[model samples]
Target: MQRTISFADKPTLHGTNVLLRPVQASDVAASLEPDHEADRLTGTHPTPGGLSVEQRQDWYATRADHADRLDLAVIDQATGLYAGEVVLNELDDDNQSCNFRICLFYSRNRNRGLGTEATRLILAHAFETVGLHRVDLEVYEFNPRARRVYEKVGFVYEGTKRQALRWDGEWIDAHVMSILAEEWAVHRGYPEAPAS
Candidate 1:
């Protein structure tokens, strides 16, 4: 069975200091490098359920073909280099909802406002172009930096899944966060309506 989905080309989203564009085939290898390095450094390598580099490439190819997933590469508009990646996944048509995930591949980009800005752009696209009523995400408690960015984007703490993830033989808690369309409108200071 085939799923109906949509993707926007050069869907330029303006961040505080970056621009977000659709992920291209050329970015697969480079994008995966940082993710792998980060995982190794943080001792959070993927489990059996996670995808390998080849698997991720295949997945990206599939996602690129489907409109249901919006995966974008965050670019630093100043230098025009790949800063990170952001994605709105698991799009549910019946509920008009999706979950989001983001990561800044380069360590140099950390602690800057880049992540927050990139997040805002993706959230705006999800709630605006994608016409999603709700957006949600899960973050490990250890990843305080990402959690902070999510909070800044108006994602409220819904609850926690105790010992939800096992990393390096230790259990970690996962924080469930979500934002409603109304909340997004309030954040953007606009009345609820589709973007033109």
Candidate 2:
């Protein structure tokens, strides 16, 4: 049976030159492409599991209707192309916090400041709409690009787990980062970007 979930109807978020909307059936193809390639480059950081296109589709189908997870498709507004994907996963029952992850499928889309803006939108929604106290993430120390983006949005490095992830044939450290609602409030300087 297909599970149904109720989410904020209009999950539209604007970035510097892109927009993030809830992931849909049509996006499965594009979203799967970059994710497959990214696996080879980074080799699954937090979760040591190998990547597969079918696995990604199944994962998306399962959470696509889940209320607790806000999975989004990153779109380049200028060309109307899919840039990547981002999500707020594992929401707590108290509605006080959740974890986030983002992946840009196309390498050309990187270094264009889209990540910072996209992250800002997600962080804004997490604090304002989700009414969460904290938003946290784990980054492989090797993924400095993502770490930089998170830091730009005020996520401080709280700690690190040495050799927490095994990729290829080696183990690597993972950085733990988090940001409080109070800190996010100050960064956006808004009352709250209401939940849709």
Instruction: State TM-scores per candidate.
Output: 0.81, 0.80
Model 2 scores worst on lDDT over the 10 consecutive residues at 1-10
Error (Å) of candidate 2 at residue 158 is 0.5
User: For residues 1-196, could you state the per-residue lDDT of candidate 1 as single tens digits?
Assistant: 3433344333768776988887775667766554564573344665676777777767656656766778888888878888778888787877888888877786776778888888888878777776778889988878887777777778889999998877767888898999998898876523333567
Worst 10 residues of 1 by lDDT: 1-10
Error of 1 at 90 (Å): 0.3
In candidate 1, which residue ranges exceed 4 Å CA deviation?
A: 1-10, 32-37, 40-44, 47-62, 189-196
* CA lDDT of each prediction against the hidden true structure: 0.75, 0.75
lDDT of 2 by residue, 105-192 (tens): 7677778887778888887877777677888898887788888888877888999999987777788899999899888777672324
